[model samples]
Target chain A: MHGLRRVPENLSGRGDKVMEDKYDVVVVGAGPAGSTAAYSAAKNGARVLMVDRRRELGVPVQCGEAIAEDILNELGIKPDRRWAVNRTNAVKIVSPSGIEIRISEKKVTGKVGYVLNRKVFDKFLAVRAVKAGAEAMIGSYVNGLVFKNGRIGGIRGVGLDGKFEVAADVVIAADGVGSRVARWAGLNTALRFDDIETCAQFQMVGVDFESLSMLEFYLGSRISPGGYAWVFPKGDDLANVGLGVLGSRAERRPIEYLRDFVSRMPGLSKGKIVEVNVGGVPVCGPIEETVGDSLMVVGDAARQVNPLTGGGIDSAMRAGTIAGEVAAKAVEEGDTSKERLKEYERRWKEAMGKRLTRYLKAKEILLGLSDGELDKLAEVLRGVKFDRISLTDMLKVLVKANPKLLWKLRGLL
Target chain B: MEVDSSLCLRCGACVSICPVDAIEATDSYVRPNERCTDCGACRKICPVGAIK
Candidate 1:
């Protein structure tokens, strides 16, 4: 009531078709998280149904298209050659003063990481879910949640065929950032403007670059201010050129920032914009909670995005795997109540909460840095002991390893 | 969708999802552009209760 709104919740659908009546679990989205959740649940023997609003899955790609190689391996997903467009060996960070430093290869998950073909990767995940025995449908949009006795009873929505209503013992709200499912299930998914980072990107063709395999990062208040501009090369002649601006620090629209950034870069300036994509990122880290009666939230709906990198594909898949497993367990136990379902929240936190907490703090500190400070940071990091960001390392261990390489990071410790 | 200046968290959900791309989000606030067409896409998709 203070800063939120809701639809009446009654106008979902008519229960006419038997196929739309129910399932053991219903996943709300078909993106990586949702699809992964459905796959995991179905694999564990849960009767699962996953629906997407898009007719063609993974079209209109809405991502930065980068994932850590280590995470992919950790998740037991074999890298698909067809879905990997480019492989970058290192990350090249350019400071405000034009000082370029390569973040150590050892620090990253792999010596080479792939730039994904999201169109293929997203579809790949959804198809996997279907193959795992989950019923997958596209062109179906979830309109509202059917609540009974203060619990999530079912879902009501529409599709190309007609109106549909499906009851389910468990619901997985794997919908993305603007998820209506979470709200309908009584979760307050409101993010503050300041907590959101405005983002815009262009898939540019005809670009000239020194390193076709280097993942390039440009930093400065003028360049991206509170966020970083990236040139993730798909090839020597093409790249995904984009920037995300911290909502509070952006003086102009995100598009304007990217336009100015593109104009100033020699290679990028000469490139033609093939496609433009814009989005918002909740940088405040994961929401306070992720579970409710007969329901669980995953992926962007739960704000599982990395506060620093704006990367959630790995984390989403990780959470989806956990949520699906837990949901299936609840169904097997014949208890879909919040008490029984609380394990999903517990398991997700155990798997992802710690890292997200660290990134949230890191994002705040990173935002306060000036160009000179960032340059100094670059200088300090040049002496790092390892190649990775050490996201899980204790603050003292990071500083102790390279005493003079960084600035006064005592606060971070 | 109308941003409730006092309530709007400026999360950019409405701005990002506007089908016709009408909303513009700056650091301070979010507003509709000339092309808004009052399609109400933003109102339906805003995560915060800000849009009405």
Candidate 2:
């Protein structure tokens, strides 16, 4: 029910038919969040345009690529063989003293998850958005925002053809961790050193796995230093090996730690590295303000990543859906003010805000524990198996065995 | 602040943590702009020791 407002004819000289100068909504970044937002907006009867700086979608994959099946189900999407490369059913957690805790559906609350081929998966989502009547412009870089009467009006950027400006009623920023879009619009999305996780990853072939369907996590100060290392399997002999180091505690670059870890591990040292990815993850939880007049920020741009797990694909998609729906409704009602856009913040908070805050608190406490404490905690639960244990129950068990942890963990209880 | 181009990955890790918006990155290169106050936030967060 929203109508597209046309810009002055002189604003754009080219008048390209495929690339319009105006749209109901313009989404920057064609990843899961942007594509999902475009798709939802278009489905809700809004004319949409999605853009990405990359010439190809998902190239140079930046993620570990593991996502829970429940997320896909909630989005009403079925896993396809083309992008879902492998399925994992369990997680192996390794402590500093070589203690292993295997958690699966039988032992704890775990579910089937997928390891994605992001290069294919990102393009697939973009294609779905296009099919839903959203126009996509790849190989484009958005460097600035267009403001009209002191409010966000549109985006200004360069595409494969040339420089262009597109006017829109609302702009969705899904530009990932280093996003400057929202900041450019006057939102303080800057992160502190202690609030981020510096990370590095290597996709290797001929790797060894303890279990083909299990994900491995190595935790210890010597291993990662206030963070952890992970191995997510892609095939029987292929895996994505990675590590994240807390920015405040990192003594060396994350890549150096990862290389040392791989060299020391017999199972990983034998593999050959095929690809390298280095990036940063914001572990600060969601920003305070994610909505402004005619602007909405979602995904990593809004710091929607899980502080404890460093997982974001699920939250990004969920937040994108809500942002898109809210943007469409605001446009339809002809009120794209900050007051109207506040609905998006309210809805996402109602869904996952409290959980993210709790995780942030847990991450702080866990990161404060020394290697000796972690070892003691792991030793206490060495052989204990639970049919099903809630996070509180697990915390209670640890607190009972090691009363030393009671003061630090009492907040969680 | 200086970016060791050889070690830099153009991943924009430094760009986000720069409080003054002093870093700029493209597909081919990353550089510190005039706004840089030598805070070292970028250097600390660089995954490959690219920033100095």
lDDT values, one for every candidate: 0.76, 0.85
lDDT of 1 at B30: 72
lDDT of 2 at A218: 93
lDDT of 1 at A305: 91
Clashes found in each candidate (C-alpha, N, C closer than 3 A): 7, 0
Q: Which stretches of candidate 2 lie over 4 Å from their true place?
A: A1-17, A107-110, A387-390, B1-6
TM-score for each of the candidates: 0.83, 0.93
For model 1, what share of native contacts is present? 0.14
DockQ of 1: 0.13
Instruction: Give RMSD to native, each candidate.
Output: 8.2, 3.9
TM-score value, chain A, candidate 1:
0.90
Clash list (residue pairs), candidate 1: A4-B49, A5-B49, A107-A387, A107-A388, A193-B9, A193-B10, A380-A405
DockQ scores for all predicted structures: 0.13, 0.70
**Candidate 1 on A1-413: residue-level lDDT in tens?**
20011111101211133143678899998888999999899888888878776666776576778877776777798898888888777777788988876654663344667899888999889778877777765667677798878779888877656778888999999877767677767777765556677777899999876687688888999988789999998876989998888766777766788889999999989899998766677677998778888889999888999998898888899999999999998999999888888888888899888889878878787787789977876665555554553544434554666686246454455
